[model samples]
Target: MKLKKRIFTILALIAVAIGVGSVCNTPNTAQAKGVPTVFPKNMRGTWYQYYTDGVEKDLSKVKITKTTYILGEYTPKVIHKYIPHDKPDFERADWIFIPGYQKQRGITWLNVKQWNEPAGIGIPDTGDDGEDGGWGENGGEFFNVSKLKGHQVLSIANTIDGTSIHNTSHWYRSVKLAKKLNKRHYKGFLY
Candidate 1:
């Protein structure tokens, strides 16, 4: 009788284990339902330029123009003029853009004329006069170019200590604008 009781207990435990396994293997119902997808569009065009100088400059004094251009599969060359008030306002450069591929990163290039412009007033205060000299002593600001879309580019940059930095310009789509700038000889491919 004890052996028969043991056999019944083993069968009961095995049945419970099988039932639990089936329940665990069931698929989630939520994932089986459908869902929608959305993709983002690119932003490219001629945009006004703005400079920030902390609290010293008024936000209203910023100047802008609609003369920028977007270069596709070619080099963008341009002559830029800068106005100096509290700081320099413009820079000339070449820009290039390459699209991204599957599992691969995109490509971009920028050749800035005066890549490092100086900052600081001519005075070094009372303590650090020896260590302070105007221009090229502390290095210049940093700039970067990124693809916003097929016909657009975004420039991200910052100053020496990484403050008052912002997006500076947007190039409008113009195939003719690329030719007038005159390429200064560059040999490279963006793949």
Candidate 2:
């Protein structure tokens, strides 16, 4: 009986050691405190972006030039489950990540009508009341990421308005910018 008890104790210790080893080998995705794993200081600045050819359609009516806001230090992990307007019930979580950036994990619908896709109407640089437009083929929209020293500008030319429309999606970082937009921001997922 004593021998059996001793064997049991030895087995328990081995199990515990194995369990600890497995846990130690597990990878942690969360950022460590005080460690700048993402969004290094150099990344915070104003930037100007253009198409691959450094040219884009003229969108004067949309007026996206004056838009400035802060982007989150960490890239959000986004999970997209597209709900088609004209198809059977189907859902899928699209895992998206920016190469050499942070993870984005949220599903958001891009309203097409409010999008400045056409070439006549105008949209405010920041607000909730722009013409809605549909999402792109991948249910995503593209924005030019320009940096400007504590402020970032995302410019998208409104094909419909013949102007650049600023999407104030980052106004929540401060108070002054929020007041300018009447406390309303664009509805695009950051994380």
Candidate 3:
């Protein structure tokens, strides 16, 4: 009787341990604390306009399409070669372009810093101007994704010439052909 009771107790303990382990090992889909995955899936894609020699080729509307990660993050060497005056330690964000109004441009990493701030306001910058206090288009526009329901729109702040030209318009449309790109894979900018 003592031997049987001991065996039964051990089995019960083993079963409880197995059950607890399984529950603990379950995959968690909840957003991790520090991981930045809040960006919507519908917004990841390539937006472009037909341009020839830096000139608009036609008045046709702009188009956006999802593509495999192609564009690479600016390496230290590339950044130094092109934008030497700017700080090398910069994070990349999604590129927001408003055709005709604001040609193809990146949302600068500065927006990330602002967004991280406790009191940061508006959508982060999708364009980089390179150096600080320099005359270039570095400031990004603020976009409220929560307000945008099924409407693809980019609100761009006109950082050029210090003008307050805030242009917000609906994109022609969005096409998703390739896998959806996110910052998790690319680190800074979405491919």
Q: At residue 166, what lDDT does model 3 achieve?
A: 37
Q: How close is candidate 1 to the true structure, as a TM-score?
A: 0.21
Give model 2's TM-score versus the native structure.
0.25
lDDT of 2: 0.32
- For model 1, what is the error of residue 68's alpha carbon versus the real structure, in angstroms, after optimal superposition? 16
Angstrom error of the Cα, residue 51, model 2: value is 11
Which residue runs does candidate 3 get wrong by more than 4 Å? 31-41, 44-64, 68-145, 148-151, 155-191
lDDT of 2 by residue, 1-191 (tens): 99999999999999999999999987677433322222333323443322122344311111221212222333222322222233222121122211122122232112122222123222324546573342222222333334433454333322223222333233212334323433233344332
Higher-ranked by lDDT: 1 or 3: 1
Segments in model 1 whose C-alpha atoms lie over 4 Å from true places: 1-142, 154-156, 164-167, 175-191
TM-score per prediction, in order, is 0.21, 0.25, 0.30
- What's the lDDT for all of these models? 0.32, 0.32, 0.32
Per-residue alpha-carbon lDDT of candidate 1 for residues 1-191, written as tens digits (9 for 90 to 100): 99999999999999999999998887688455322111112322332223234445211111112322333323343323432334443342241111111111233322122312334532232554443321332222222334343434334232233223322333323434332221211222121
Better of 1 and 3 by TM-score: 3
Candidate closest to the true structure, highest TM-score: 3
Q: Considering summed lDDT, which 10 consecutive residues are worst modelled in model 1?
A: 95-104
lDDT of 3 by residue, 86-180 (tens): 33223422222221122234433111112211122233345685423212343433322222334443332323333433343222233231112
